[model samples]
Target: MPNLDLWTFALNCYAREGVETACLELQSQGADVCVLICAAWLEARGVARNQERMCVLEEVAAPWRHIVVEPLRELRQAWRSPAEQDEALRELRKTLKTLELQAERSLLERLQTASREWDESADANQWLSALAPKGSCRVALETLRNAAYQTQLELAGV
Candidate 1:
């Protein structure tokens, strides 16, 4: 019981009631407009392809140069054997972990850069006085001081 408007119905018709079919319909309609709409829909859905969702996802992701078709390909491979599926999952996990490390490194680098940019000759007292009106500043400063001390202690290993 969903609302099917003329556009959706038409797209559904274009989708030929399927992602691939709709895509083909759009293509048949005209490449330029179809590709743009298809691209937007794919991006919003975070759509990825695998054998099961291949027809739909491919149509959605086709407009982009680098489409995430791994899942779809893996799904098809997995259908033949469980071991292949496990391997695909393992590979995905490894890739995700590497991405996480890279993101953390980027975040840490940005934090260090911001800290350096804020560094000045101002003493703690002066900083506290200036920031006193904003009551939370002292607490934040104390937390930062504690973290710095901990870092120093860890470096010293004592």
Candidate 2:
């Protein structure tokens, strides 16, 4: 588990039952899915949560998400209905989806690099709670947290 990367961990956690819905719910409420995934990764790795690290991660992610991911997502969402009728538009939308995913992956890599040197601590990891948006759905956040813990156990073969 020492070498577990954030992207793989995020994918696995997201693939778990209820996790996608949970993440989507959180996302719709203004939480950054990538940052939430990074939080889950850090929690699973036993990295203690603190305001300083949280700020650093947010600083690293906010601009990229606003400038790159958000525009692609907005464009794709705007095309959703039109793409249903136009084949070419559908194809273009598909490409946009792929690009959006790539952008998220790139963001995850940057988050990993930013937090790579942080040492794990015995202090309880509250990353998921700390990173989740205020007034967010508790059920969705718990779903994400449970999936992440289950993913960690699965990866550790426990």
Candidate 3:
């Protein structure tokens, strides 16, 4: 596997067809998109899944998602209607969207830093299943998984 960093890997996979919608569905089901992207990166890199490591990544991500990302996202979404009617509000909403993205990028960086030392093996693709929220939409998860697999192949020059 190529040694792409988490943020780059995430951007690649999330840009794939159907991945954004699948991720949004997963997010609506209470899954953290950042953590899910981290899981995809780990899977692509063949990093083995374990409770301890999952916990560690979640620990690194959850607080920031709650305190930083979500609030920005919520505010951005909340302003959508009003912003459509006001130029200044639209500009501020765009800035909020940028901040939300930056927050998510920071979370991905934290995840990558936390998992930097994990050993990789051939059977490490179980991360998506392990990290996905319970009762998540199977179709959405499958879409994400397939995109991640395609991303892995592309990175490997397959």
List candidate 2 stretches off by more than 4 Å. none
Instruction: Put down candidate 1 lDDT per residue, 27-80, tens digits, no spaces.
Output: 343332222232222222223323333233234434331232334333444544
Which pairs clash inside model 2? Answer: none
Question: Sort by lDDT, best first: what order?
Answer: 2, 3, 1
Candidate 1 residue pairs that clash: 14-22, 15-22, 49-72, 50-72, 51-72
| Residues 25-142, model 2: lDDT tens digits | 9999999999999998889878888899999999999999999999999999999999999999999999999999999999999999999988888995779888999999999988
Which candidate has the top score in lDDT? 2
The candidate that wins on TM-score is 2
Candidate 3 lDDT, 40-153, residue by residue in tens: 878867888989999999999989988999999999999999999999999999999999999999999999999999978866757888889999998988898888888888
Q: For model 2, state the Cα shift of residue 23 in Å.
A: 0.5
Candidate 2 achieves a global lDDT of 0.92
Better of 1 and 3 by lDDT: 3
Better of 2 and 3 by lDDT: 2
**Candidate numbers, best TM-score first, in rank order:** 2, 3, 1
Q: Provide the TM-score for each candidate, comma-separated.
A: 0.28, 0.97, 0.95
Q: Give the Cα error of residue 78 in candidate 2, in Å.
A: 0.2
- Best of the two (2, 3) by TM-score: 2
The alpha-carbon lDDT assigned to residue 11 of candidate 3 equals 88
